[model samples]
Target: MEGFPTVELSGRKQHHCAPLCLLHFGPEGKMMPIAIQVQKCKLRCSAELTELLLRRLSQTPGPDCPIFLPSDSEWDWLLAKTWVRYAEFYSHEAIAHLLETHLIAEAFCLAMLRNLPMCHPLYKLLIPHTRYTVQINSIGRAVLLNEGGLSAKGMSLGVEGFAGVMVRALSELTYDSLYLPNDFVDRGVQDLPGYYYRDDSLAVWNALERYVTEMITYYYPCDAAVEGDPELQSWVQEIFKECLLGRESSGFPTCLRTVPELIRYVTIVIYTCSAKHAAVNTGQMEFTAWMPNFPASMRNPPMQAKGLTTLETFMDTLPDVKTTCITLLVLWTLSREPDDRRPLGHFPDIHFVEEAPRRSIEAFRQRLNQISHAIRQRNKCLPIPYYYLDPVLIENSISI
Candidate 1:
């Protein structure tokens, strides 16, 4: 804590000092700075002022080094030197703007990159240039919304930008590029680590697909202004029908042909189940009620209301017929897996309570399995094709 750096900025009538605080332990046990405490400022501190102060402070020998207040002659020279440096560097509009933008972009990209899982190769391959593109794409919706954009319009632009960046990122993934340290590939398939078998890139694509689909379904139906306009409504409907639901649409290239398409579809099932977890958190008990809600006598409900609970109200609120069909098909595909090999771990931040009653937990999993099987049988008569998974490797990639 004492080793941390502090900086003091001086001006005509005031001075401000900020000490960087170590807030959290990062991976590999490195200390990460969480905040800077700035004191006694009349005006808001700009990044330029903070950066200038830091640059000046770093000239000191070490964090333990102390600065003595200047004598009369020394004070005059210091003031003059500071003024000259500010005039030469900070006064230029073009240079200042470029530096500010670069700093903002770089900061955002680095923050995101740091959050990525260390197990994936994509985390290592994520160069600053590519991350900058991802940052732009991630914020494209907010930019559009700032420019008098509608929800549907903003979402469409966001999806388009996200898809473009994703395509470029995915294109970088190859057997050679991913399997680093030639020895990693030389190991037998059985000896290769679980992460190596996991295709993080594909997982990222699956998440992106689910997110985009959910957004489209959520906004396209609710935006009355867009839905009311004939032209806008037509365009929105066309995108929903042709681009998302129709597999034949060339307008929005899914890149499914090049990658394993099974997980892309399977993510819908994962999303549906994951959505229920959110519903539970928000006290939306229409789908499934948390165990805390049940009485002691009825802690174990009937088979119909066992671990998984389904309400007609929630089911009816789902997207249109085509979307629902695809979701069910994905759920069915997932149910076909053996009990132990189910993809429950693929979900984001999901954890089962170890202290929970074993009987109740097993009941819940059984209910989930039953629901998936029932949906599969219900859709068995339809011409819903299955994507084989044995040869298809699953990726564990993430998208912002």
Candidate 2:
């Protein structure tokens, strides 16, 4: 064996370091540790520099032995696949973390109900937390229904906090029911046994509506105020219209039509913002970033400024964030597909059955652009702050 460049390792003991060396052996020969350079508490070795050293190793000539390195495109493809797996894993971890932390969980639920944007300085701090929250909320709604398993005893999150969790969890269930893959529906029901399975999108939509109705009835019993409140009634109707009965459009996914769904999708994001606030107030979380100088256009406006009177204010700003999130994910998945398209079932006025994957992606992007642009225009009229539509946030989110 010849001399190889060494890399320093920190905060690891010799017993733990032995296995790492064993794991990095090249096909040419076993990696032999020639020297151990110790400085202070750090242990350094040359055996672990596999990527740099392996390429320099002499190849053994044989018909069975082949030497090849992945091309840049191949490396990218591998990385993209890894990124998807990481995202999924991160989502699972986030849900588990929330289940363990009652305060964070409560804050998350509260954020969902309030749906208010935090100031830019605080918003940036919460972005990563919100990302994890959104992913977990989207994928872990079913897991939340296991009350016996996830119950946090001796923790006081208040009645409102509990309600927020229940509502957001139900909202996630609604989203999942509407957008689950056909194979997932089939296999999931079969594996569970005796669970009701929806065979088509329409069936799924109906089931979601029923679930939402039942949840509202059970969680928020029919009181005179609730029943008579026009805003609440209209909000419910809008949720149904956008989530279950919205018309198909070229830019937006047929399943995600309105701002309400977007609001639901980003429930975790809202929770993160609220959670950070709670943490900061209670001395649990701190920010190292300097105070942000928000743009003049983004500065708080006078209360007298005209804005959307109804929930349309929420809807208008929401779609911009929602469209951006959906489009980025759609494009990412599409780019990773073997044919640059994934079959997402048929929609009204669209012949998806015979459409090329490339064409479908193009149409989806076009629809996403249109929705984003429309929301931006609508946001201009609103006096309220719009953190979700922040250009920096959008750019950072898409990259993630």
Candidate 3:
């Protein structure tokens, strides 16, 4: 309100107005709102002044930008969060600057931008940076511990986009660190249920699944290869049994309810088994050798076996959906660039005709024949461009 001072201009011919602070003079020098305000320019200062007031109203603090914990007190604090977030939302240069300058605000902005849709280009940008940091043992440990204060940041990255990163991070930590503490185990397993509820969370799960699935398919031999490690083989079989049994039972939940998890499970199962079969059926070791190139790993033998079974079981549950999705994926994956990007042109435009009380089957059949004859006739006789047909002529000719 102090900044929102009003000014008064009387019956005077003037080009410019006085400073706002001067106009609010009152009795005994106390300030008061001016009865009338004059605009220096014909353009409305009212809108401009209103916007300025709004900006002041929306001012927020800089710290605690990423995590919007409810207890944030100052307006400036929330504002800082939005500012940092939008900056990161807009430009990579802003991210680089923030990282280089240790601008927590910029980092906060970057993390906040992850809340955008998984398909958004911004997700792709931020995901790679996380992967780069996760590869290092020290940074990854910090990430796992949440000491880096990136829980929201981690959650923001899309799952599929971050598949490789997830694999590397989870694998490295699993292998190099002490056994997951009871707390970590408890938190992780509990968090997964919630994670699997959201569609975006499925992306992360899918990536992890892909790695696990591929690993099992490559290593697990189809022809009694379980002889080398009978224990490992037994675990795999058990996992597969449990997964399949759960799916077959009435206890299994609807896919829509646990969509994210189901999607992840499906990807892992399908890809892993498919990869395995590809190797075995082709008599090629390509899939097995290519394992290290993927974004994740299998830390424990039991977990790996279970992951495979889980994937396979999940895949079994969504046969039709899986087939359709895979066909689309394959078409998209195999499509030629530029040409493939063009939409299909072969589809016919359909028009639904409403039934009339007086209409007969014979009349409908006759109309159909007429249309068919017209189409053939036009194809044979009219070699002109499609656009050459006059609208009036078409309307007259097509009239029933």
Candidate 4:
């Protein structure tokens, strides 16, 4: 019930509180949450809150822990769940969505511009995916992450705390998990049932790998060829030194050696710029429309008493009308497709003119089209459709 090592999150100074939710399989084998453990630390009524929380459904989590479950007041349980989701919203918006995809892509795009020639195999293969990323990221820094920006207005973690999240995530992050397949294995979610994101990501990653292999092999036929290319080496080293801060702990390569290595690295960047961004960024509007489902901020502190919650209390905890409007407007604007969008593999800039690479592009487009068709057919049968990673819907860059 009591949090420690207090830090600011909700504008006012307080311990960083986040609920631990426990889930399990239901009667029909459906996965549903069983309990939510709430903590109140460094607040005015800590002892009273703990006393009220002592009477709970489960005690294994620890003494004096406020538990929200099915047996509790329905409004109390729902509000608890919403508060938990609010924490996830900050994590998703700050670290997973903005920092992981957009900011990192901008770094890659800058490295490419500075090191690779216009005709370099990697430059041509990747330039299309970096299109408009610079402009979008610049605007995001100004309007979305500025001191009193949308993040401060709508998020529980004001803009300052939001920036802190990004800094911490960047410091602790490594390159190993960015590789999609390794990420699946590392997280032990490779065989997690009905995880459409994992299933579709692997399919798309394999298809992407094939295309990158074709491009890299057409140019650098052997390991010696990869090691000999100065532009390629410079590009990777700059990314390691400048973007990754020359951290040996990061495991980013200073210089690529083999053709397969180059192919795999290129595939990782393209996947992040295209598919990963689409998965995390595109579904904001539909998921957050029902404010309570994905609340951006909480107006009141979390409930301390077990039987004190009511419908009015739950409604009062939600963000004010102004914050709600701003958050929804931003989500709607971002979810809409840009006018000059290029779907994944739909390159129109003609950066690569060689016959072999042109044919590879054609093949890549056909593969993505096939993936789109399969996803559409599968979505037709789903009770709640999730098609964010459909290659046809994914832009070639983090343009929005």
Report the Cα RMSD per candidate: 25.4, 27.3, 29.5, 5.4
Q: Candidate 2 at 162: error in angstroms?
A: 12
| Alpha carbon lDDT at 135, candidate 1 | 43
Best by lDDT: 4
Ten-residue stretch with the least lDDT total in model 3: 391-400
> Which ten residues in a row are the worst by lDDT in model 2?
293-302
Writing each residue's lDDT as its tens digit, candidate 3 over 1-400 gives 1121111112111111111111234355433333221112222366775575456443222332122222433332222222222222212211221111112212222332434344432232123222212222244234422422222122112222123233322222211111112323544443432221122223223333443333333434243442344333333243333322323332222221222333333333232222211111221122222222111111111111111334343222221332233323322322212221211111022121323311322342344344434444554654432211111111100000
| Candidate 2 residue spans exceeding 4 A from truth | 1-355, 387-400
- Quote the positional error of residue 69 for candidate 3 in Å: 8.0
Model 1 alpha-carbon drift over 4 Å, by segment: 1-23, 26-33, 36-259, 272-400
TM-score of each: 0.17, 0.18, 0.17, 0.89
Global lDDT of each candidate: 0.28, 0.28, 0.26, 0.80
Q: After superposition, how far is residue 34 of candidate 1 from its true place, in Å?
A: 2.8
- In model 3, how many backbone clashes occur? 16
Alpha-carbon lDDT of model 1: 0.28
What lDDT score is found at residue 51 in candidate 4? 61
Candidate 2: C-alpha lDDT: 0.28
User: Model 1 over residues 21-131: C-alpha lDDT tens digits?
Assistant: 224455655443332221212222456544654465432223332222222244332322232221222112112211122222243234334443433222222221222
Candidate 2 pairs with clashing backbones: 251-367, 251-368
How many clashing pairs in candidate 4?
A: 0
